[model samples]
Target: GRPLTFPPGYNAAQAFIDRHLDEGRGDRAAILSRHGTVSYAELAARVSRCAHALTGRGVRPGDRLLMVVQDRPAFFYLFWGAIKAGIVPVPVNTMLRSRDYAVLIEDSGCGALAYSAEFAGEIEPALAERRPALVLRLDPAEEAALFEHGPDRFDPVPAGAERDCFWLYSSGSTGRPKGAVHLQRDMAVTSELYGVRTLGATAEDRFFSAARLFFAYGLGNAMTFPLWVGGTAVLLDERPTPASTFATIARFRPTLFFGVPTLYASQLEALDQDRPDLSSLRACVSAGEALPGDLLHRWRERTGLEILDGIGSTEALHIFISNRPGRTRGGSSGTLVPGYRARILDDTGAELPPGQPGRLWIQGESIASRYWRNPERTAAAMVGGWLDTGDTYLRDEDGHFYYCGRSDDMLKVGGIWCSPFEIESALIEHPAVREAAVIGRADGDGLIKPEAWLVLTESAVGDDALEQDLRLHCKARLAPYKFPRRFHFVADLPKTATGKIQRFRLRLGAEPAG
Candidate 1:
């Protein structure tokens, strides 16, 4: 595939708003909600009103607007409001606890915040603690009442394509989250490269994304792509558990679904008991972690649709490697998407041949320029315009990428480096183990030894024989050096809001006492 380019005047992305709402498919539903469906005209008008409201509250071009809301109509309004005023929209995860939210609020350095009233109390004290410039209460119900009189026509500010657009933070699974900054051009690049080329989305397609809008994956799939193609995007205002997710899919009958690996796995399990009418789901995408081959096979068997897996990060904005539908391999995170260049480089920065394990480096117009306000970390993370993904991967002979694990997550036992994924994947293969996390801890001899924390499939408590049997199973499949030295039965593993295993927490559990 050839490199892709964004359309001219992309920074003025909202400039096309009138065209979308007027000349284009105005009758189509732009957003579907349980309360009501919003047409293209309504969504555009609300966005314009929100922008007017922000301006009246002292926000201006080049300012930052922090949005912490669920997948409601107001979320899109606030997002476009920021764009309309030439301000950057920084979305904070609603699933974060109050303490985490406190840290995020401080880190974002946003002058103003426009958030749902539901979360106002949770963040109010935190806001008081930091005291941002302005706090605008965004009650959707209240706004709807006021929308009756608000101006119907407003103009968007002229912004250049290279202007700073928005900021997104990492999930901070390891520690404090890092805020990644992207240009306005990145949004158009994502739509052109992924939406137009990879997804083949059009105005008629309805998109349903399980990932939250606060997440990079969700932002790209749910908001940017649909808007770019003049398609409709279904926004679920609640947290997407398997049950609620399927119910929304059934009601909306979305043409495309985007989710994380864990979400897909849980959905597959739910289908086994009582299936939802998902026939309208033409394409599905997975990210946030490696899609297990077992889960992939089972999902296909159940849904009769292939789950296309991809690899992405907040720094890169969204997916870079994706198995585009028809040309997919069930296991591999397919070749690089258009408009991007990827290389597998060894420790010393030499390019590695195909099939060799190395750190994956990617360079593209879509890549975020730097982590917001953290020059030292940014310098360490990105080099020579390439974003160091920190993921160790190998490209097969066919140029498809396979995730090994994070570079820091690689365990060193004796002298050889081992990927925790190998052990975790093997552990999950056992019938009794439902989920597993593997980490290396210092043994009595000062050598690193692998330890496994497992969530059992059934009640196998007090079964010493079962533990020994699992150990033997690992011994048989893995080399002696690679097998876990100890196993601990756990009810569940610590996970972030995105359902990613908090591997750092697991490592902390294995630490020896002072």
Candidate 2:
């Protein structure tokens, strides 16, 4: 791919919000939501007004504005609007405790806060704790009269390519989250590398990601990618369940769908009883976790569409290594995208040979320069301009990368390294199993062994007979020691907000969510 460039005075929002109008796509539908279809023209107008609203309230350039909003038209207006105004907007997960919101408020030291009324139970208490200088409740009047009444046009403040534009909190797949500060050029760089070159998105494409826009992967999938290509993006405010998602796809008729592995498994189970029209989709994408090979095969057998699964990080902004549109390999995070370089390295920092598992390191223009205010973590992760992904991977002879478990999540049994994903994927291959997670557990001898936790099918029973069957199932598919010594029938596996399995949570007395 050719190098991406911008004019002398470029704002990141120009590519996403303002570019469509410049390219003669103003009347095109930019957003499809439950509220209504929003054209690029209408979206741009709202964004400009939103920028004015912020400025009128004394929110200035370089000031952090904490956004605790949901997935809606308002999200687009405020997010891009703030960037256009030269204010850094920090959007966080809506489903969180009050303490979490409070932490983010204090962490960002934001001068302004915009929160949805729907989450007032959580947001209000957080505000009561540490209020910002400007607070806006996202009521009907707040959305329209406040932001909508302002001037419909504002000059986009020039944000050079090197200027910090936004901050995305890490998904906390391991434990603690870090704020990844992204520069202005990252938005366009990733949209070009992965969205256009890898997935082949264009104006004709309609995108619907089950993942919401607050997270890094979702930001690219639902917000930046579609906006960059001038494509129609479908937004859902409600949580992404099997029923809602299927119904949405049927009604909206999106050409490209994005989701995580767990949701795909659940949707496949629902397909066993309900057949919804998925003909509108040409390609489905999976991220946040490695989609099991067996699950990918099952979906292809049921629906003709293939899932282009890949790996990405909040630090990198979006997918740097991905399965190409027509060249997907189920278990592999396919070849690197055009602008990125990947390395599999040993514990000592030497590059590992092909087929050897090691920590993965990546280099790309979209990679975040550093974590906000944390010099220790910044130095550790951003080593010599390379981002240590903290994920263990092995590259096969075909230049395909296979995901092993996270570095700290790998288990050693009988002196041989075992990947939790390897056992989990094998367990998911069973007819009764819908999802599976494996973690190291200690026996009476104090030696670590594999323990399996499973979320079974609706009709399946988790009795002794089923346990014996699963034990035999694993014995036949995996190594003798690799088969789980103890099977724990669970309602669901604990997952992060983005749907990646929380193996660390499993190690802490595995309990299902209510």
**lDDT leader:** 2
Looking at model 1, report the run of 10 residues with the lowest lDDT sum: 1-10
Q: Write the per-residue lDDT of candidate 1 for residues 55-114, one digit (tens) a residue.
A: 777887878888888888778887887788788899978866667767877888778886
Q: Encode model 2's per-residue lDDT on 311-370: one tens digit a residue.
A: 998999999878987788877888888889999999889999999999999999999988
Which regions of candidate 1 fall more than 4 Å away from where they truly are? Answer: 1-9, 140-142, 145-148, 459-462, 511-514
lDDT values for all models:
0.80, 0.89
Question: What total of clashing residue pairs does each candidate reach?
Answer: 0, 0
